[model samples]
Target: MRHLLVRLATVLAGVTVLAAPTAASVNLDVAGFGPAHHALAGHGVGYNINGYNWGGYAATGSGFTSVSATWTTPSATCNSRSDLYAPWVGLDGYGSSSVEQTGVATDCSSGRAVNEPWYEMYPAAPVYLSTSSYPVAAGNVIHASVTYAGGSSFTLTLTNQSRGWTYTTTKSLSGARRSSAEVIIESPPGRYPNFGTISFTGSTVNGSSLSSFNPVALDPSNGVYEAHTGALSGGNFSITYQHE
Candidate 1:
């Protein structure tokens, strides 16, 4: 399979407005968690907001004041069956420096729902894969891969503790192209702790592809396992649950 790296640009800016002195200034901040960090590995990630607006506006003691805000959505796609490419943990702090709120997501596409298992049904769950039965040793990374099997693509997820994780576009199987959907998980603070095995669950897309999930017991030999959709060659996806 060919690997690719795509960067979604995130922008942050501030603006001022004129309003009554008694009016309060509102601040906003947005953060996305999940597959968005990696999009070339069939992760199908994206970002968005609903039910509310994000960002802040201020008044400068003017007779009339107005405040406006906007955001950019990452380039992404998901099949009802194939995979999901957005943050399950969504966004927060729409109009305040510090507030607690959930992020929003768009529905999946038609083709992906038919072939991929993750989005086959509505309201999909998070897919997890076990890196090892035990905590991965320091300075070590876990790896894996997936291939197109004559049908629509699928979704895959993994967990790790490396600071920077990425995919390559120069490598892949003979006939299939690397997907623009990918995700990278980073390690926690302090020393790398052993997070148990990674597992996967499936969600259906409304009018897209078919998604399936296979549960695997922990692998003891390589401390790594491959997703059923493809194989792990040369350990392409690698990360150690470690700290800087």
Candidate 2:
């Protein structure tokens, strides 16, 4: 795959808005998560860094060659078209400008829940799978991984174990830094849907437990949109929705 465009983002009133990266850019590309921007929102619990749209633990280190995690896709209760939630495992988005990640996204379409699996080399658009072949539904056991094979080549895999389907791709991105690993639930660019409680198991970086990297907890700090991040246990943790 070829992705050469970048998405520019701005924080206005604590709401992150992704707009054109450059005025001269030609494509009407969708915005994406670039690097992890840290700001301490005092109201958040264990306020390690302001995650903006990220709510999970990120293990930051250098030369992170692999990051993987498994989770059961949560059922999102939707009330509006703007509701969106994505649980993903990725590399570099926690501290670097590039994120090579893949997982499932639950979107509210016409006020109903719609789920699909996708891979992204951000700040590029997410590549939704061949919807016909890569069908994903709620409660599916999804395992995702982004592995640095060598040089500029990386492999991203998203598997739907409950449905017995796997999608894997290898792409070369020249500037990828492979800095940090993450297992995150992101609101992306909309109102986060009610995903109840979702947990991640077997979280690992470079084939080791994610907690071994001194994982930092981020709360996303979005008022009622904030969530409760459970304590990490042997590379496993949970994020329960907290709407107040």
- For all predicted structures, in order, the TM-scores are 0.19, 0.85
Best by TM-score: 2
Error of 2 at 8 (Å): 14
What would the per-residue lDDT of candidate 2 be over residues 169-215, giving only the tens digit for each residue? 99877788777899988765535778889999999999999888888
Q: Which residue pairs clash within candidate 2?
A: none
Clashes in candidate 2: how many?
0
lDDT at residue 82 of model 1 (Cα atoms): 18
lDDT tens per residue, model 1, 71-158: 1222222312212222121111112122111111222223321111111101112222122322222232322222222332322221
User: Lowest-lDDT window of 10 residues in candidate 2?
Assistant: 4-13
The local distance difference test score of each candidate is 0.18, 0.74
Q: Least lDDT summed over 10 consecutive residues: which range in candidate 1? A: 1-10
